[model samples]
Target: MDRQFEAGPRVAAVICAAGAGSRAGRAEPKQFREIGGEAMLTSAVRLFLDHPRVGHLNVVIGAGQRARYDAAVAGFSDPRLGAPSIGGATRQASVRAGLAALDAEAPDIVLVHDAARPFASTGLIDRAIEAALRDGGAVPAAPVTDTICVAAADGSRGETFDRAALRALQTPQAFRYADLVAAHARAEAEGRDDFTDDGALYAWAGGRVALFEGEARNIKLTTQDQFDDDLLRRAGRAFLAQGDVRTGSGFDVHAFGPGDHVMLGGVRVPHAFGLMGHSDADVALHALTDAVLGALGDGDIGAHFPPSDAAWKGADSAQFLADACRRVREAGGAVAHLDLTVIGESPKVGPHREAIRARIAEIAGVAIGRVGVKATTTESLGFAGRREGLAALASATIRLPFRDEDGL
Candidate 1:
């Protein structure tokens, strides 16, 4: 029985990645292959998981692929992502398995997508969901540019198709959940599993599938040549040009106070006395955060988080660094590297260098290799050398899209 489409239906997505992808000439499945330094499956799943309209999500993986699937989605956790479903022999069976897995959620609408097509934008997903809610079923398609012809057994053209009337289909095909479930069930009952895509399967079951515009960049990675570096650059997954690189430096100092330990780079180190400041006095993190802001051409840390505010009293300075990194990302940039030098006569940073580096990397969402932590002594010449306080100097290197006004 077909259920009627309603307003604001609960939308779910099924990422089908069970095929062997032998045509792509890869040892592993193409979906598990890397694109822009990330698994194609990961790229595809991230899109749907990030979309506000997508409610529940699931990925259908081939058998004996649990390890690969785990590796692909490592560090990715969201309430919307459900358990991975093991797929069957054929693509049709795999999608059926995925749909069956989602049956427990009982979504009102479902989008069946190919994991190899990672460039499906949020706007495309929105169009799919909207068309499904309004038309019961829909597929995103672009008009065919090349003239197509039906060839005979000997490869001679038997019929020619008007290019204007032809369309190249792309996933994710959307459908009313119950209606699609029923359609797949009918096909299974009739021993028909040859349908190329969900849209074709639904149409075979007498479901009228609608069409919406699809992006030219929303292409499927079916051939080995499609995995070119140019494609990654087009997807914004590649590193920016060197001309966009920028560097900024920052320095901070704090006086000795009456406390047992001090926070430095999000790590607590035992000391004779803590540094005095409105916050926890993590001078290392403060300098690094300021350095990031400086690279972004933003104001210093004090301007963003004033010490005059009581709300920041004893606040963890890691939050400050995290917020600064967030701003860099929001400004369409990435933190390339961070270097910090701590100067003090006591509470030696040598023992905590690795720990501090890891913590800073975690806060900045970069690799530990990108973070450098070191210690230096003032030889008892300055306040830091006299054990009166601690000081930190930081340098941050960032990459951003270059602006024409910079006159590179």
Candidate 2:
């Protein structure tokens, strides 16, 4: 409809998340890897999802990563979130792909952002928008804090560049949508895809560019160390700020049945017999799920995924745990800790304790250290001691907001 800067301009965000993250040394792309309980790319895309100014959201990802990308963002749904677009060989190509995807609506303003920079605040987005409105294109930039040098090939001392005049470019680089698309198209035609970012491409195409204040903490996740600490996100500064602490306990049991393997704690463990239930019967996960739901004042597993329903027949128990975690988030809470105990006489849990913990963390979307797994026997006292069945007990500690109606 050609809504170019119309009354209440339509804003679109192009998130470039195609990088393989070779520097981070991870097998999966850094964008899809979990960072602070969520994928880095998802964390970045969510900021614009519910924004009033952002009418459309497009994300570019690497080829053959659709399933991986979908899994990372499966928990988030918003009207502004658009379908995924496959990226090209380079970052510039990826941004252009996202912009092309955004052409259907013809938004007035476009913000080209990196999915690696999850910390880009809403205030920064506003600043970029303001600058782009004033200038033809705008990029958020911070003053070069470190002295840079143009060194020679053999480590010889060379000309030193003045740090005061240099600026470190950041993303969510805002621009007139039409102009930015044209610039990218021109670069592609001219075989000038060498530019590292859209700002450089715009400048190379003789477009006027303005620099706005950039956040010092909004660092892109390139190296492993940066993703390791993640202090800002791990600390839960954005949410989980209240003092309403709560706890809950859960227990689940399933008798041994006919199968070669059993699903326990989201991990496939080998055994002569499997657990019998409507679902895959991940006893550990079921107990943990109930623990989380109980902590949130929600119903237990049977109430949610009932055995009467055929849909839950052989259904993966991971989904149950995922749903419980989502409810915690919906209730304005986060899981602080999870303690699980596995009771059985055979098929030792010690051999797979770490793997079980890792799977639980992945399913709960929490850190591995936050999950504790232990195994014990009832000393020949009950069904577990008789090797008739296995049991799991779980405890969950969570933090939620204080509501006066709840009366603590």
Candidate 3:
């Protein structure tokens, strides 16, 4: 069979192996269990460490499993995979700690993966990484093949959910290192500790997240029945040389009317008149915010932050955009790149382009290089040309960190 490959940016893999795996009924943690000829965690770690693009590796092991994990990795002399560290109480905590354990020379991107999913394939990892590089953050997720029933707390079925809208999220969730670090710090400080995954914590912190199709073969070894060496090995070999990528587009506009100031990329840009709207009339920010939200299949800005509420009567536009970006990032996605074009002859985009990009970078918690800003004139043609007010258009490319067998 012909082999296929996809290129992606530098990434760090942070394996969460701190869980006890009590559900698996194993003498040792499932991550330490042998899948084929190697420990599960070791197998998973080897995947990313072997990848050429993977620049750093951090393994978060349970406090007591350090010695055993160390022994398991002793044979793999990859300097990129740093020495393991003790994980925290919860999975989120473990991820945060694992990210912290990365060497001072951390990679530009980070992929947080579940060590128990020993069957995760390199193709899935490549797809996730490609998604992240294009969209900002990425995660491996399989469609909910089984019928989904939404049950009430009283043990009664409330309603059946749309299978098309359902997905069984899986790991190797990836993100930009700096954004992930900041998000974790923010969530920790805010005392929001109820997340079941890193992506959830990221969303709560207002980061954009993107999703990639995951292979059903890459099953999490959560149950004894699901543990099969043959299946894992088969899946691994089949996807050893495959990869994928996806792209999305977003655009938003608001007419100029009245307000104190116009918000652009989460920064207040001085203007003669504020754009008219419920929230702060930041045409640029709104456009950017919608672009991100739209890409994630999340509702538009109005649906998220409604104008119906009086609280947002004159709220800051930057906050709205920041919050939206937070949702995206928390979903294991990153703002790969964003290009915004402000329309209108007044308030020249030339002088403010760099400032707008900087502000956007700050809002999305991404490097300035990943954000772009430019301006164009209507050539005195339409509404913008008439100078009735100013308008803006934005396109965003986001990336999701993906977990690959080769830690690239």
Top model number, lDDT: 1
What ranking emerges by TM-score with the best candidate at the front? 1, 2, 3
User: When superposed on Cα atoms, how far off is each prediction in RMSD?
Assistant: 13.0, 18.5, 16.3
Give the Cα lDDT of each candidate.
0.88, 0.85, 0.74
Candidate 2 wrongly placed segments (more than 4 Å): 1-6, 229-408
Better of 2 and 3 by lDDT: 2
Q: Which stretches of candidate 3 lie over 4 Å from their true place?
A: 1-9, 153-156, 227-408
lDDT of 1: 0.88
TM-score per prediction, in order, is 0.60, 0.57, 0.53
Pairs clashing within candidate 2: none
TM-score: the better of candidates 2 and 3: 2
Candidate 2 C-alpha lDDT tens digits along 245-361: 889999999999999988889889999998999999999999999999899998898899999999999999999998999898888788889999999896799888876876777
- TM-score, model 1 to reference: 0.60
lDDT of each residue in 169-282, candidate 3, tens digit only: 889887777778888899889897668887787777777788888878677888865655677677555444223222345566667766556666666677776677777677
Which wins on lDDT, candidate 1 or candidate 2? Answer: 1
Show the lowest summed lDDT stretch of 10 residues, model 3. 238-247
TM-score attained by model 3 = 0.53
Error of 3 at 72 (Å): 2.1
